[model samples]
Target: MRKYRHLFRILYLILLLFVFVNLLLGFYGYAFTPLLWNPWLYLGAVTVFCHIWYRFYRNHAPNWQNLVSVLLSLFAMAILVFFIELFFSFDGHDLVTIHSEYYIKEKTIVFQRGSLLDAYDEYHELVNPFVMKKKIKKKVYID
Candidate 1:
């Protein structure tokens, strides 16, 4: 572990630098130009490269601490990518709501904000359309 520790440290630093550079480019509207646009793909490639370095050069299993660090860094990069995508999806809209969990669950990117609600409540009114449209009242039961 001590023999290749310095080399691994350098690789980790390079990974951090790469993510930072790409984040800057992404914010400047150059996300999907050359590389570093797709966070998952780039980060996955970097992880694989790190894994190969550990397997071949170190000739041993990777350290858990190093793996966890790399994964967390990659997660931060993914969040940056999500923010970039969300920024671009808006087109001078009055209201914008981002549902990231839904995007992760379903492989579909929802660009338009709740069209019905946004159209109806343009001034950001806290109106529940369902309650307004429906006449169903809550049953009160006491036991």
Candidate 2:
């Protein structure tokens, strides 16, 4: 119906606004810790603000009110996963912990780089990720 279409439009606008705000925050790192600042966190803050805006339109736009919140949460979760993978990769050395979706169903982080560490590949994730990540944990990140 005409009403449902309008609801979608309203939801779209809210989503776009949140994206723009998060983009700005992503560009400006927090002062507390230079490297510690993450874009997703900044976006999360803005998303919360947008939630308040959604509350204002709740009565008339109840159907689409919480849609933005759901989407934003999903988006933030994806970003978090990416950051986690990057962190683990650098610390994981040649053995990058990868989530293989093609072959395995369960979440498996594989550390693979070269044949040198191939021998230790089995032990790649056996040890703590921090310790498991060594320059030669198996070998260099690249061959």
* Candidate 1 lDDT (Cα, 0 to 1): 0.40
TM-scores across all candidates? 0.27, 0.29
Number of the top-ranking candidate, with TM-score as the measure: 2
Runs off by more than 4 Å, candidate 1? 1-61, 92-143
What does candidate 2's lDDT look like per residue over 1-143, in tens digits? 55655765676576566446534543542111111223434444555545555555554555564677667876776676667645543343222233211121122223432334442232222232122222221222433
- TM-score between model 1 and native: 0.27
Weakest lDDT window of 10 consecutive positions for candidate 2? 29-38
For residues 5-97, write the lDDT of model 1, one tens digit per residue: 676677667766765654564454322111122443445456655655566545545678767866786677667666755553432221122
